[model samples]
Target chain A: MNAIEIKGLQKNYGDFKLGPIDLTLPEGCIMGLIGENGAGKSTTIKAMLDMITAGGSIRLLGKDARESSALLKQDLGIVPDEIGLPEGLNIRQVEKIMADSFRNWDSKQFYDYMKRFNLPEKKAFKTFSKGMKMKLGIAIALSHKAKLLILDEPTSGLDPLVRDEIVGILNDFTREESHSILISSHIVSDLEKICDYIAFLHKGKLMLCDEKDRLLERYGLLQTTPEILRDLDASAVLGKRVTDYGAEAIVARDKVPQSFEIQPVSIEELFIIMAKEA
Target chain B: MKGLLKKEWYAFLQKPVTFLFPLALFVVLAIQTKSQVILMYLPLYFGILPVTLMSADEVSHWERYMHGLPYSRSAIVSEKYVTVLILSVFSMLVSGVLLFFFMNTGFAVPQFLFLIAAAFAASVLLPSVMLPLNLRFGAAKARIALGVIFAIFGCLAALSVDDEGGSRFQLLEKLAGLNISIGALTGILFAAAAVIMAASWCIALMLYRKKQF
Candidate 1:
């Protein structure tokens, strides 16, 4: 079964509109949503969670998203960019609250994650650092035994060490075949490390969605003179940069002539090129 | 529901002084002055506690985070109403104890019960107006709206005095003229408060459901 399926999702504010987006995340696979700021990544996530009234049909675990029942929520764990626990709540109090909130809450797992993450049990949320807060959020999201996790910018502002640790934890989560994740982040490198599928959003529209490996295979970076780049087919060059010394362009591998050498493009490079082009 | 309450409980404990100061003041003043009139304001204070908590929730952005949880919109709206009711009952119980002590000071048994009922009605009625506004416009804006409402009511109340030594004496005289028993008046107040509270809950739920975080 697919973990999440969204069809024709759209939301409109007076000044901005996010739209008609269709996305599907297959069960047990992680799909990374890559976008720049205001690219509608968070908006799409909100729509899928039914946090906003959007024009769309969303199904989570075969249940309608609008049917936000406790049973449906029990199987879904979510982490927003900022963990929004009351500042005065200590770890123990948060555990107590979660215990009362979720019938399947595992206190042992929570404590274990706290210990592993080096989060202080006695400290209030207000005292925790940003990295600690994020670790705590991830710990809570993992301890609940949720089948699907929706994380929004979970690793955006963290240091590289903390980001790597979080990435490792996410990798561990997907070890279970039933556990899936739909994570949105502007930090493409982190997503590249863990995501099997990639979806790029630019200006509220989905630019492309495909397997990460397929994207890397289909697009290659070409290093040549501006004249050579200019000579290439417009359709072949997805994005380009021409300096006085030389020129570099993202070219469709199949469309490029065999005479030109094509280097594999990283997901970050691909996203930047694609987003800039859009 | 339990989780939301637990959160509020922790929040209450965080600033116990903020929540308990009014009650303590009411107790001290009632004891020192030997007056039951101060008991009326205790429930009014308790009724606004939910709005105060909502301000904290706004600062922490818990309301937005809560949407990611399993709770429905109605549950979210219902929690505030429940919190108001809980605080109202606590205020009533505290006032009941105070009224019990006032029994020796010429306070009649029926009047004592009526006072509690009146306090309860005021407690629920205040939040009935405040919660919907808070849900519709958020905590900060709702606070302004509430201030305007209170100001209007205060002005209307001031106008009703007719310069005849205030409205309290006039109200008592009118009530006496009506010849309604304290028991019947208490029942009417309780029934009116209940109906208003139920309607307020529906309004709050509707407003909250339409709100986009």
Candidate 2:
């Protein structure tokens, strides 16, 4: 079964709207949801999790998000961008609460992560720094052995040292082929490193989604004369910018005949190029 | 449910205010035996602060985190009622022990029992008002709503006391009718209150479960 699927999802805020988004993430793969600030990435994630009273259809683990959410959430682990840990709940108290709350909570694994993260066992969470608080969130999300993990910018404020540790943890989870991760982030480079697939969202709509390598292979920017730009099919172009001298344009990388000069494009560059329309 | 209650209990203990509960009343009790009026009132007051209004768990926005865990929304709400129930019982016991030492000379058990029950009811009402308010408007707005309600009640209560035989006086007259024999009546009131609480709790749970975080 696919780990996650969303279709025609709609949510309206007074000033902002989300979705009518369609996307999927297969089991045992990392799908990076890439978007700029205020681009509706968080809204889509909240709706998919049924955290919001959303307007369309969403399915996680093949069950509708609203009707069968409780059962579906069992296999899912989520870390929202904001810290949700209750202050003054030490690590020990958190474990007790989780153990009672999750049928599949792994005691040994939870404690093992606490040890690995160097989190204080008895220190109150109110005293925890931003990075430490995030570590606590990650520990809880990972220790349950969830089949589908959803994270919202899990590394926003961490030092590089802690960030690498979390990346290593995500990599290990996917390597086992029994788990998948859907990570939403503006940190395009981090997602590029770990995500096997990519979904780009802009203004609450799905712009593009494809295999990571296929994206690199299919989309390319060719700097050329306006005359050459006209030679390209306007239908094949995602977006374009024309300067006084020439036009820089996005075309299917492989479709741009080998006869033409080309260079590799980074994921961030692709997001900017695709999100910006003529 | 036990897990949730335990968390609530620990949170209460961790808060210095809950600790101040006994401290503040003890000072009042020390001044004069008559001030057992203040001692009898302490538990309900703490209930308002700790159980209903300014809890640490709510401060941290922990309910959002707890949503996907094993507990159901109904379970979470039901546990809150149970927490207040347990706290009321515990606070009643503490009030009894202190009342014992203060009224050791007289053993006025009937009046004392009435006072304890009144304290418990007063404590429970705060949550009845607060739980719905908090669920509807959230903490920031709940504070303002609760403040306004309290201020209005405070002003009216003072006016009623200053103006002899007002509706406030009649409200107390109903309580003053209690005696040792009225324990059965108190028990019935507790039962009715429990039913109303359960109904309110169901509403809060459904509204919260369906809410957009």
Candidate 3:
């Protein structure tokens, strides 16, 4: 069964509209959702979790999210962009609270993660640094034995070392074949490192969704003359820019002539090209 | 639900020093007035305790976080009600004990019971009005809304006291002179407060269910 399935999900704010989005994440894989600020990454996650009343439907682990959300959440762990640990409580107190809050909360696992993260148990949450707060959140999220983990911008502002550590931990989390993850972030590099599949959301619409390998294989950075670009099939070109030396275009690697130079494309470059095209 | 309450319990500890303010005030008033009457106002202070806890929840944006947890919207709404009720009842019980020691020599037992019940009723009234407003508009906006409401009511109360003719206070004073027993009056007040609280809980649940965050 797929970990998450969203169909025709739509949410309309006065100034922005999200969706008509349909995406699915099969069990035991990590899917990265990529978007710019205000591109509706968070909205899609919220809609799928039924946090907001959206226009369509969602299914998590084969059950309708809206109808059986509380039960479904037992197997779901989420780390939102902003951490919400009570400012007054120390990590020790927070442990007790989580222990009481989640029936399946594992105290030993929580303490183990805290030790692994090197988080001080006695320090109040208000006194902790931003990075420490994030580590604490990750520790709580990981300890719960969640089947499908959802994270939003989990590594946005952390230092490189911390980001690498978090990425490593997430990679380790998916070693269990039954576990799946749906993570959203603007940092394409982080997503590229850990994600099995990538989905690009541009202005609330999905630009593309495919396996990481397939996407990398399908699109290439092409440098060619404008005249040659016109001769090439219009459908083959996803986006183009006129440079001082020549015209740079993102084109289908398979559709271009053998003579045309093709370079590898990173997810960041792909997202920028697609966002500009939109 | 236990986990949510535990979370609030720590959040409740956030302002431990502030909790002493009311106790200090009560001590000073007790020394100055030498009357048990000061205990009656304890409900008003304790009622605001729940509102203060809600402010902590807002600062942490807990409502948004709770959506990711294994809690229903109704459970979230009811948590506040249950927590506030516990805090208010605890406050009333402490005041009742203090009232016992400071009771006037000639004051009857029925009047003392009425006083305690009235204090409890007053305690119920604040949360009953404030919880729905807080849930509907959020902590900051709800605080402002409550401030405006209190100011209007204060002004009306002052005007009624000054006018004296056909004022609600006068009606109440005249009722006190009637043949109704103190126990009966307390029962009526308690019953009315109970009805209002039950209705408020329902309204708050509905408002909270519709709230976006």
Candidate 4:
């Protein structure tokens, strides 16, 4: 069985709908779930943890998510989109709390992360800056020897240096292929660096789920004339951007016509073309 | 779940509201109602301590953070229940002494047991009513709903207070000639009410477990 499988996950809130989402994350890989602000990233994560009212079949580590939440959460450590640390707690307090809560929490690992991040042991969380808070969130996430670290926008508010540091830590932490991560972020470049698989969600729907290299290699930014795109194959065309200079067709890069030149698109530009349905 | 409970207690001490409101009301009520020593202080005796603790927690959105910890929903829920149970026992001990000093009516023994039991009954009721609501609408909305429910309950209690009549109270007249010791029966009723309070807490937990937070 896959490390994570979500099938027909349905959750509705009046006009807001979460799914009919179907996805799978094979073991021993990082899967980046890319989406915009309101594109149901957090909702899907919540549903996966059985933290919200949801109807679906979800298997994380070969157990039903709802029936086996108590056991499943042992392997799963979730750091939400927002760091929900207690305002009164210091870094030390957080370590104590996490240690007491998670049976597998590694106290030495927690303090090491805190030291690496330069998070103060005595300062209350409320006194920490936004970046420090996110660091604290990261520290807690890494402390538990978790098999699956489900991080939502873990580095959204940090500086590039801190972001690099955190990314380096995550890369090192997952040294044993036994650990996997399903991280969601709007920062596609960050995801590009770590994630082996990529899933794009747009307006509560799954746009595509594929390998990072395949997605990058497959999608091409053809910046030739609009007339050129009109004469080319339309079936494989995922999206287009029209500008005064020319038009850009998000065509399969490997499949581009011999007549026109192709340019590489970064993950962000690729998402801009392919992830948006409208 | 010890993490959640420790955090709850740590956070509680940092805020003045948790102890201040209960202490203020307990003292004020101790001075009211010709000093029944236990019944008039019923608001404090019944639910004040737990209410303060739970309300403080509600204000902090601690449950959301607690969910980040590796704890079963049932364990988290039971911690809240048990916290209230512990606080109720503490409240009876603290307030029972205060009652003795205030009434000077030899209430140390019987009233201690009665107040402890009744206070627990009251403490349990607030969470029993508020927990599911908190799960559905969160702390802010649940606080408003709880305010309204308790206000309505307070009004009903006030309206039922005795008028000048041959009987000490209207409720007393209604139960006249019954061989039951009203005080003893009330203690029994409160105990039964406490059981329902605990049961409702379980139901709220089950509901909250599936609720989107």
Kindly list the per-residue Cα lDDT of model 1 for residues A1-278, writing each as its tens digit.
99989899888887888877888989999999999999999999887777778998999988898876456888888999989989999999999888887778999999999999989999989999999999988888888789999999999889999999999999999999999999999999999999999999998898889999999999999999999888889999999877889988899999989988999999999988777777
Inter-residue clash pairs, candidate 4: B45-B119
Residue A92 deviation, candidate 1, in Å?
0.6
Candidate of highest DockQ: 1
Model 3 residue runs over 4 Å out of place are B158-169
Candidate 3: the clashing residue pairs are A101-B3
Q: lDDT per residue, candidate 2, A1-278, as tens digits?
A: 88888888888998888767888888888999999888888888878677788877888877888777666777788888866777877999988877766778898998998888899999999899888888888788877778888998888877888788888888988887868999999888889989989999888778888999999888887888888878877776676778898888777766667887766778988888788872
Off by over 4 Å in 1: B158-172
Tens digits of per-residue lDDT for model 1 on B9-28? 89999998987787789888
Measured against the true structure, the TM-scores of the candidates, in listed sequence, are 0.96, 0.89, 0.95, 0.88
lDDT per residue for candidate 3 within B146-194, as digits (tens), equals 8999999999887876444656567767896897998999898888878
Ranking by lDDT: 1, 3, 2, 4
* Count of residue pairs whose backbone atoms collide, per candidate: 0, 3, 1, 1
Q: How far is candidate 1 from the true structure (C-alpha RMSD, Å)?
A: 1.9
* DockQ of candidate 2 compared with the true complex: 0.52
RMSD, one per candidate, in order = 1.9, 3.1, 1.9, 3.3
Candidates by DockQ, descending order:
1, 3, 4, 2
How far in Å is the alpha carbon of B123 misplaced in model 4?
3.7
lDDT of 4 by residue, A1-278 (tens): 47889999888888888778898988778999998988888888888887887878988877888887877887887887667676777777777777778888899888887778888899888898877887788778777878888888888877898788778877886788788889999888888899889988888877888998888788777887888888777776788887899988788865666666777777788788876525
Chain A TM-score of each candidate structure, as shown: 0.97, 0.93, 0.97, 0.94
